[model samples]
Target: MALDDSMDRDPIHGSDDNSPDRQGRSTFVAGERTGEIGVTLSGLRPPSRSIVEISPANIARRRLANWGAIQGERVNVTRRETFEYGFQAPRHLLIAHERGEREDGETLIEGLPRSTLREFNCKLSFVPAGHKFFGWQTPRVLTRVTYFYIDLQDRLFDLESGGARPTIGPRLFFFDQAVWDTALKLKAEVGNSDPGSRQYAEALGVVLVHELIRLERATTATARLIRGGLPVWQQKRVIEFIEEHLTEDISLAALAELAGLSLYHFARAFTQSFGVPPHHYHMARRIGRARNLLQAPTLSVTQIGVQVGFRETSSFTRAFRRFTGLTPTEYRRHRGG
Candidate 1:
């Protein structure tokens, strides 16, 4: 995909990272100086995607591949990918939040106060070595410092947010190998030699999105049954069953039978109790599990999608994006693990 021809002249394009001069009293990276492109980011909404595609050939040459602007708002820096290209402008700092015990992978980081986001001067670069899709390195002299996982198994690092004198977020980097795997899967699946398989993979990304949007609006009570407490127990049992065999073609009929009821009765009961119907609930669980897999430092969006019942990488990505506002790569970046 050719980029906009005008991005070349944009302020984000700078040859040297050490060209900015301090005017009044502003913080700058010691030893290495970077230019600041002044811009406001108010009302800029973070991406609501859940997948990323990082292929070697395309990823090696860095460029402004995935970013958008809002009217009269601060420029937002989103999940930047690694390639050979140099600095990008309108950079925004990514603040990583700490992880919780139950948080297995990238899925644990959710419901952030986007309203409380701090800003920072930011840019991304690729490391020469490594099989992983993403990795991170702090700035050092001589070599271009690439923060966050940019190699293959990329990792995130919390940086100072807000203008030249930005404050850094608290300590905590969410590291999950699964995110790397997912990216790799997408590269392979979408880049597969078989065109039919590739199209199927792409189609899945679309389906995934449709299912996730439905899940986002779903409520806990809406997920319960009219039978009240008994429905609750059944729902739990169904969830457990689905989790155990998610890889299988588990269907509403299968689930209904598991609960010793007809498909119609089971579907209605399940929907009444859980807010979503059986298939939708199952999809929610699969997507939820997929989110956990995405947190792995090694898995890519595609790989995680496959692991969570998505046969095609694109489908997984589409679905993941719909459920979370950010793509898989974006989600991992925010988590900083």
Candidate 2:
């Protein structure tokens, strides 16, 4: 199939260790990540997603690639702190936030208004080829996400004409029971050593893509601007300011001024656009940045906390624990630093 042709040239071989291959199922290697799709997947450029896609600093990953049709990665954030993923890809990508709740954060896709909806467990997000998607969060718990990469050159074909249409629009943290179930089945197959598990996993991948096609056809109605949210230009300006000031104490009045709205209206509209109060969102971004810093040991915990705007170590630790269920020290330990 052209799917294999679209993926990285490396082939997935059976694991030599006496664990999975003997079960008569095609193997899922637990070794180096340079398997079928890892190379090109990590090769995409600037504002590099290699850290997020290949080996996130504080994440422990278990990957499964079956027949080079689809690749699935089960990611466990070792700590409950901040984390993010982003970048464009050469192929279709789907993400399942298996278990996560973000106190503050947002999902930015190329064509859609950014999504700030929190509490996104069991939610699915799709990024079409060449579209940029990035998101971050100060997790409310240790997060688990299942990522799927499908190397599909022409993702969809209209049956009547049998010609491929565009795959699908970028989806940000949406729900579709059929698609979710199929994705979950693929993730479960990661641990399955049963006979035919390989074939079963690959079959599930096909079903999952088809389910997405059905969803796309069902929703071609059109996407309208969110009535109560900020206009795109105003939103872009406000978000740009907020992002640049993540480590500073930002005033709501200042943000409102930047949005050209009165304080009360700006607060409401900002919440409508971002799904959280501006201060909460700011704090979440700070905590999230702090987490990435924790992944490296050069900085002391206290210095790291101060850098994210907490003046006192205790305050930072308390806030970090409140959001992530772990202190900076404990999180660092989990990172093996």
Best by lDDT: 2
Q: Model 2: what TM-score?
A: 0.49
Per-residue alpha-carbon lDDT of candidate 1 for residues 197-258, written as tens digits (9 for 90 to 100): 54544443333222222332232333354445235567778878877886666655677777
Residue 48: error of model 2 in Å? 6.5
Give candidate 1 regions above 4 Å deviation: 1-233
Instruction: Write down the TM-score for model 1.
Output: 0.32
Full-model lDDT for every candidate: 0.37, 0.67
In Å, residue 49's CA in model 2 sits off its true spot by: 7.5
Candidate 1 scores a C-alpha RMSD against the true structure in Å of 25.1
